[model samples]
Target chain A: MTETPTSSHFKENAHAALHDAPLQKALQHVRVNFIDKRAKAVARLPEFEALRDSARDIKDHTLANLDLYIEAYEARVVAAGGHVHYAMTAKDGVDIVLKLCHERGAKAVTKGKSMIAEEMGLNAALEAAGIDPIETDLGEYIIQLRGEAPSHIIAPAVHLNKEQVEADFRRVHRDLPSDRDLSQPVQLLTEARGILRDKFLSADIGVTGANFLIAETGTSIIVTNEGNGDLTQILPKVHIVLASLEKIVPTLEDASQLLRVLARSATGQDMSVYTTLSTGPRRPGDPDGPEEYHVILIDNGRSSMLGGDFEDMLRCIRCGACMNHCPIYHAVGGHAYGSVYPGPMGAVLTPSLIGVEEGGQLPNASTFCGRCEAVCPVRIPLPNMMRHWREREFERHLSPKAMRYGIGFWAFFAKRPTLYRLSTNVAMRALHWLGRAKGRFASLPFAGGWTRYRDLPAPQGATFQSQWRAKSGSVH
Target chain B: MSAREEILANIRRSLGVTGAEAPRRMAVDDRLAQARSGIIPQRGQGDQAARVATFKDEAERAQASVVEVETAADAPGEIARFLRDSNLPATLRMGDDPRLAAMPWSATALDTAHGASDGHDLNAVSAAFAAIAESGTLALVSGPDNPTTLNFLPDNHFVVVAASDIVGDYESVWRKLRGGYGKGAMPRTVNFITGPSRSADIEQTLLLGAHGPRRLHIVIVKGA
Candidate 1:
């Protein structure tokens, strides 16, 4: 969360994450579970493709009129007695939240999980302003305590194991019996509950991430497994809901439709444990809700995506289904993508948000596997989007010189098919003689990574084009 | 000069939409009805329950205990014993429920209380506002008997459920909330707790109680 791994320069971070054993294990678990669960969920729906198309069309239509929907959402929230704040950038979002926290003289804040907040680096800003932000979501709290960015979108700490948590608790709670048997799962929960309970009641400000913003009702929906979002929204005197501007849905009905795909795609569940709809602050005569509510709508480079070819990117619900189902994502994991958002979505979103200068390499991280597009509920053509990012990156001179040259060579060769076929046949015969071991090759030129993992089958003696030509009697 | 304009202008510039805006494609009124009517086709009777059982089985496999009882009265003693066995304090926080209120708790001496109150007391007893059987979730709504804070603040939290309150699906619960609630009414807080507070942040190690109740005790009592 702290570092932008997608930036062209963060190769060091990517390399580190790629090799980190525990990180690798965690990534494997997320990749496998998400892929399997999403496959099963998609299989259950007879109209999966049609539903995806509908969701995509709805999102596209809404985004095309994003400005209108945002205005309407703001009006509704204001009418519902909530104040709306627009943030043009991450800095603006942080500044607004900091100002609100300062106005309330807040020293501590209880937080609900919001990836956008993490994207904007909100916690550091609050801490710098002297407000201790308490992450109330169990996963968020764990990552916060560990002082790390979330590895996955929905399950922030999906990469972690149980024993490591025991060590962290022991380190933080020194007074507790160090020997407290925590190998059992319940014991760990008991320890965390004991600590976070005090923070929930005592924190002066509550911060949450909004899943969807319904323009019609001026309501925000937050879906979670733990009940922290409810406490984060209701317990504090001041509640600040942070969300990306693209999250706006025209109506509660649209919000529900999105939520339907959301839980099923993310966790293979009919619905999350908690699907809460909060409309502004508590009304008059309401006793137990926040006295003041603030909705900070963050653009942070999103609106630029509205009408362009990449406009469909706004339709993403952050369901992470595409990333979950991507084979390349499974093998490489999120950290390899090098951004706050990662995996296939990150490959497209990171470059889109940060521009090609920093995030260009992200798009090239994909294999153009259409699995992401197939699994995406909103049916965003993620591979195509990544390709666009690649094209943009190339146009802006962000792609590496070597890759650019390689692409140029391929393009040139593709145009001269007869020469390309002749050249490739000769090259393939030479490489086969040099590399073949029985039927497979143990090593190949310019493909060390692939060869490192598994054996690469040797090339056939004749080229496919040549075989086709012979069959068609066109060789003469 | 104004906050709204400044914010909007800044966003427009950064997004590079300062000069021209995209043509509007759809309006809000066009999408209202479908958004609010979040209906999923109702599965045949008992299919939802079967799915819920699978979820419960998954939770059980992960080591949390699951039990079903007829009423709320039997909850206090079971939770007390569980806490005792776990060596946690006798003080517990209980959710507020009518069935729980119906139970005669004069027999037990531990702290009996309900809403955002100080939970320094170890053993607090309350009732679940609703039990969502679909996810094996216990809904805790903020009220006089069931304080929202009690569900989160206590180290050892006990949830009492009546088998009858169990609904088959989340959609059913939504329908109940939507169709039944009067206009302009919302609970102060509605908590749907599936498992105890858990995190797997440290080296991917799953930590059970990093922020909320470490132990979740569910008491299913006989007909209240």
Candidate 2:
């Protein structure tokens, strides 16, 4: 399964997203539900902010000593009778997983919701290998049936309404009764539950993503509200954990610290319904569990993100808080970013993973409102990292010619204080005179992007600096 | 180079360090060895009765039903009553946990089966390893005694948690786990379940019973 990035076409994607009526209706769920729920959850926990700080420090310590931790973690996994596979690239990860399935003679594979699998494009690869990869998460199952990428990380089908899901279920589950009541969301859920239950029981392999990999005990933890991940891993003969290297934490206590903030930030729950920690496969004499446990640690591009300005990006726990609070994401939704990840975190991290040339447009999509960083469980400096990407885009000339010239013109005046004040003062006065009658510009040269959407309010007679100077002189 | 070696080398290169750096190695080792607790929330910390009360309150807040019995002997009766009240079948599936086995199931008029669920069970019961008051979560460790399948496959899950095993926060549960399983050694799976399975994937309207048990009933043994 190959993923062709349209991140370079972010403008067209976002413009199309803005006008798409169904998408606009679906995105309302995100804007209305997430913010209030997060606020209530935060209000319930008085020490939430303090926990966030602890979580951040833990990630920082882990990232700094990542090599040692990885070695320690690998040893522990081996000690527990599990194998660890390292993937230097996405293809290597997929290849390793496919090989494992072949060795086990796996024909059907059930999966938990995993963003890493999405990043690796595992479903397409599995299908190509003649392995049926069935997604068990309701949102993931909907998107999988529709043959589309996830619009949001945690809420994969956040961009679809129940009507669309009802349609998808009808289209896919042709064996089910046509007259079955499929009106409410609960009806759709019940139908999917019954259908996926069969996949869970019969699948030969189960795959899931790790929220945190504990190096102390070689444990892989998954946090989920739905029990789909639990059923996915437990019901199959082989349980394969697809995780990036940065998911590692040093100990269970460190994992606990991160867990305190993760669910609250992501879904506004005190704790997700299930926070399962799996060490190896089924232990000796265990009644039920996977027979073989394999952890495929993929580094794709995260290792290069260490010890740099973007190193803080590794601190992310994939909580989706950044996107939940992002204005740009609320406006354009996840697919508009045209990367595996979206919103503020995606803007900074996608470039490093995919390449700056293709993913550079993502950084420019943000409004720099700083809400993402404010609510981040690990306190990653998302806006600052995005600014860093913008700088790199300018340095490498990846930015458009128009944007380069515009910044250069601004820099020319910005470097000279007198010229900056003079030019701004003149331009403001001229615009004030020109817009005296209407007090806004419906159309303006070189500002079509702004005017096309909404009228640009005309500038007042003088810039803020001149007004401040006049007020200060009068006061003296 | 192998993928493992190449990936580690790239990480070391990016961080501008050799893998053998002493201080870095020491930091990692020390953290793993110490396993120090950080920022325990005060909400879950209190006297024994307060902790139990907090656990019950928090669990209910997470949408799980909590019932307290005077002793372990009364657990089966309570489970039977819950089944009858909910209009569920009088059948229960469970693993061979001693605490659950010790309960006098013969006293109740319910049919019981042993071993893990095969995804067809309507009701299942298991003994919790520990309960965290901080988030009203139950910690269940997987083994021959309490099979992991009992936690997920049943339509209704009933957990019997001893009141004495209820801890203040998650960190306390880790301390208990280390005491039981030894440091740096864990069960095959340690499940921290807060409530019945749920999902808000559809239009952000929260719904319970999305794959796991539709109802989670906790019977807290107070005196035993």
DockQ of each: 0.24, 0.88
Local accuracy of candidate 1 as per-residue lDDT tens digits, A163-264: 776777777788887667988656776667667777878899899998888776677888875667876877789989999988887764456467657767
Q: Give interface RMSD, per candidate.
A: 4.7, 0.8
Best by DockQ: 2
As a whole number from 0 to 100, the lDDT of residue B140 in candidate 1 is: 60
TM-score of candidate 1 against the unseen true structure: 0.81
**lDDT, candidate 1, at A372:** 82
TM-score of each: 0.81, 0.98
Clashes of each: 42, 0
Worst 10 residues of 1 chain A by lDDT: A1-10
Query: Where in model 1 is the C-alpha error above 4 Å?
Result: A4-6, A10-13, A37-58, A160-189, A283-287, A425-461, A474-476, B1-27, B33-39, B44-111, B121-146, B154-224
CAPRI-style class, candidate 2:
high
DockQ, cand. 1:
0.24
